[model samples]
Target: MRLRKGLRVCLFCLAAVTVLIMAVACSPSSEGDTTTAAPPTVKQPILEQDPPSGETGELETESGTESGNTEEETANGNDELETPAGNRNGSAGQLYALTFEDMMKMDEALNHEMNYIAVDLSEMTQLTEDDKTYIIEYLQGFGAEIRDRTLDQLVEEENPDQSSPSLKGVLLRVDKVEINEDSAQIEGSKYRSGTGAIGVKITLKLQKGAWKLSDSEMTWIS
Candidate 1:
């Protein structure tokens, strides 16, 4: 009976040892120094990269001006609406015809030049030097210093009084010139005097291969 009791004790001890080993193996480890995990590091871009090929990087308005920009540059940028070069003498004549008409009202020519009409065509690029010469010739002998005057540089060295032989001249500067096959719209200003200046917008029509003034409006008078 003692031998059987001792055998039962040995079997029970062996089973208890096996159960304790399994529990220890399955449980989370706690042997090393405990440490808290850190989150992943994410880096961000400092500057955006350039756009791909054929894509526009920066945007600009139609009226945006660039370095060394000029009137010709601005006008030629609109390729679809660009006008043919050197095809506008009608509008040119229309701008100066009114002055000629007023001169015609006089019965006779003046003994000496009293008033001057100097046209500045630097802004009107559609006309060439030859075109300018033609206009000057057309307005010649009108009791004014028209033929002797220079259209490109309207300024005279001296601005003399009426009593002097030098005529009181006005610098005619055309700011904008728009022309089509059927019509033309022109904006210009007359530098008569500091206080006697005038700005004009003229609409002209092409009739019989000539530009005739359809209407003229004084935009500003000072």
Candidate 2:
């Protein structure tokens, strides 16, 4: 009986050890089953740069002046007189025609010469405002001048007024006119007190349909 009991106890002990060993072998190994944590994700930063200095990056207007600037600059930059459409051709022929019209508007011939004398005096001497004003105000119109005596009766008169000449000669006459689109060239003859018949070459431009004097640098030769 004692031997049998000891055998049973030994058998039970062996079975428990075998079961423990099987459980440990059959279970998954911690080494192969373990999952590693993903590495922390990194974010990139963005950087911005400044623009260059003293560069406005704005365009200038057609008037040759900058917008949003001073009024003085704008006024100075603007051309006071604009060339007319027909006169913009810059042709000598066109200028001559326009100049003739301007000349025709002056006072008569003799009065025109006197007006020139007055203008010369104004330039040569520093006359008072009253004298200058009088000369400018009393000058003849564009086409005709005024004289004190009549040319027909002057020679027959007993004592002709020697101070004032009766005949009023044409001060200036428009001989020819040439126009080239924007420009005009005029050839005319001018009679002055000291200078006899003097030929004049005038250049004009078409500004707003009216002929005006062109810039000296932009003279039309042809």
Candidate 3:
């Protein structure tokens, strides 16, 4: 009976040790619940912001105004270069029918000789031999009838009072321009103190990029 009691005591001690080890392995830990870390969160970078309402409106208005100004400038530039359909005169691109303003300028150049050289020569021929010689030389420089006028006739034919049908004028005003291929007909009038008025036809030819006085005819004089 003493042996059996000792054996029971030994068996009871082994079972208690085994049970304690199992409880220690299976229980939840304080460190796992309170001190464990969580995963890190990602961050994004900031770039730009939208403009204020007033500033945005102002910018849009300025852009529109600039566009309008550019268009107006383009139109004005084109106006100068515009030509008639088919470029009827055959001289197209930047060279069109002469404007009235240009016609007036041409008339001025033509009449300059009539008022000064012609009248001056007519008066000079009567004064002296030297004056007559000078008048002849001067008239030679002119193109047509004035160049052919004899010295004696110059002295006798001078009619500054406009009683005779002669060209003596202070102004030449061009009123019409008729253009043909490489040529143009210009009609205008001459005005003088005593001569009253005269209608004249001038023909011009384009040669080497310039309008040259090809012919001139008097229609009527008063």
Which candidate number maximizes TM-score? 1
lDDT of each: 0.58, 0.45, 0.52
Query: What is candidate 3's TM-score against the reference?
Result: 0.28
Estimate the overall C-alpha local distance difference test score of candidate 3: 0.52
Which residue pairs show collisions in model 3? none
Give residue 193's lDDT in candidate 3 (0 to 100).
34
Each model's Cα RMSD: 18.3, 15.8, 15.6
Cα error, candidate 1, residue 123 (Å): 2.7
lDDT of 3 by residue, 130-219 (tens): 333433343334442323233234435565344444444343345566878688786765554334556777777878775556776668
User: How far off is model 1, as Cα RMSD?
Assistant: 18.3
Candidate 1 lDDT by residue in tens digits, 1-222: 999999999999999999999987877765332465455798977997877644553334323555337766766787656533334445554445543333333222322233666666555566556566666665555556663344333334464433323325655566776878788777776554555566777777888867676776668866
Candidates sorted on lDDT, descending: 1, 3, 2
Candidate 2 C-alpha error for residue 204, in Å: 0.6
lDDT of 2 by residue, 1-222 (tens): 999999999999999999999987888775446586456799878778655543333332433464445676667676454322222232333333345335434322434443232122212133344433333333443434422222234323423545533323533444555757766665654443333334556677778765577532212211
lDDT of 2: 0.45
Error of 3 at 80 (Å): 4.5
